[model samples]
Target: MANSNPNTEALALGRGKRPKLDNETVCMRMSSEIRENLEQIAEQYGCVYGGKPWLAGLLRMIGSGELLVVPAPPAFNVKSAVKDRLKRKHSS
Candidate 1:
């Protein structure tokens, strides 16, 4: 049988009726710049959480209205490249 709710536009999932939202969840979209900034920050934050990505931790704290973009540590990439070069030198 169809649901008794009067506010539904139509049925969903073959259910009786769609739900009425008294307090609907809001979806917020951000600009590309904002998204990129968040991702970078999340990655850096991810580094120190027992390998738990920074994004997950940041998302958990989202309600405080504090977003960040932390600069990656300088030695991160340099060490990788140096390791690669050393490997190549040893292989040759």
Candidate 2:
């Protein structure tokens, strides 16, 4: 039976892998944005950076494909930073 709820179909998008290309796999316009974001993130992780990217690491996340081009989570240290600055100023 088909899914009755639209939400089910939306959530199930790309949940399964398509059959692997038998002859040769051809990638289309995958946008340079993907690579740029991936490289910046990989550099932050101290993963493969600068030199040629390691193939093994790429294989591990092939399931995510180019969608891994997400921006890094913002860091929050405001409270700690303020406390440390106050301490230094008072101590001086």
Candidate 3:
């Protein structure tokens, strides 16, 4: 059965949409402990009760300098060289 709510209907149609203002994507890696802490904090602020209100709150904190962002160190890439060596060995 189709959902009667327009928003739900739109979502059912694969048109689930976010606000126009939200047009960017950021990816970060963090420990599970940190994630749990953030979720707890969000709940305290009443931001975790709904769809990504916690994320919005976190973004706001970051924008206001309440949170700090540190860049991760670069990772080494050696897969291609290893693959080439393996291929040469196999072809012999």
Candidate 4:
């Protein structure tokens, strides 16, 4: 038997239509910490259509000023970050 709901059926069949987007592809490099923070931000605020975070949508939101990208606070220290990572590594 098939799902009565088309959306559900499409999802079940792995046939969900990919949204059309611009042909241009953008890529950049960032530190692991920054990338992880970005992913966290996406998880928190980027799901407009699907339940999961959409990175492209998140970037759009940032570009549109719907989301604000702020620098870390004054007290944020690079040495402290390295130390924290080291602690986690040893703890594991």
**Highest lDDT scorer:** 4
Q: Give the runs in model 2 whose Cα sits over 4 Å from its true position.
A: 1-29, 49-92
Q: Write the per-residue lDDT of candidate 2 for residues 15-71, one digit (tens) a residue.
A: 565656554444445445445444544555455735745333453455457426454
Candidate 1, residue 64: CA error in Å? Answer: 8.2
| Residue-pair clashes, model 3 | 0
CA lDDT of every candidate: 0.58, 0.52, 0.62, 0.72
Tens digit per residue, CA lDDT, model 1, 1-92: 97789766544354685567575455559875455455555675553366544444567555455654466787679447556755775599
User: Which parts of model 1 are misplaced by more than 4 Å?
Assistant: 1-26, 47-57, 62-92
- Give the top-scoring candidate (TM-score): 4
In model 1, pairs of residues that clash are 45-54, 46-53, 46-54
User: In candidate 3, which residue ranges exceed 4 Å CA deviation?
Assistant: 1-19, 49-53, 64-92
The TM-score that candidate 1 achieves is 0.29
RMSD of 2: 16.9
Which pairs in model 4 have colliding backbones?
A: none
Taking the candidates one at a time, how many backbone clashes does each contain? 3, 0, 0, 0
Q: Model 2: how far is 53 from its true place, Å?
A: 4.9
What CA RMSD would you report for each candidate? 11.7, 16.9, 14.8, 6.8
Cα displacement (Å) at residue 22, model 3: 4.8
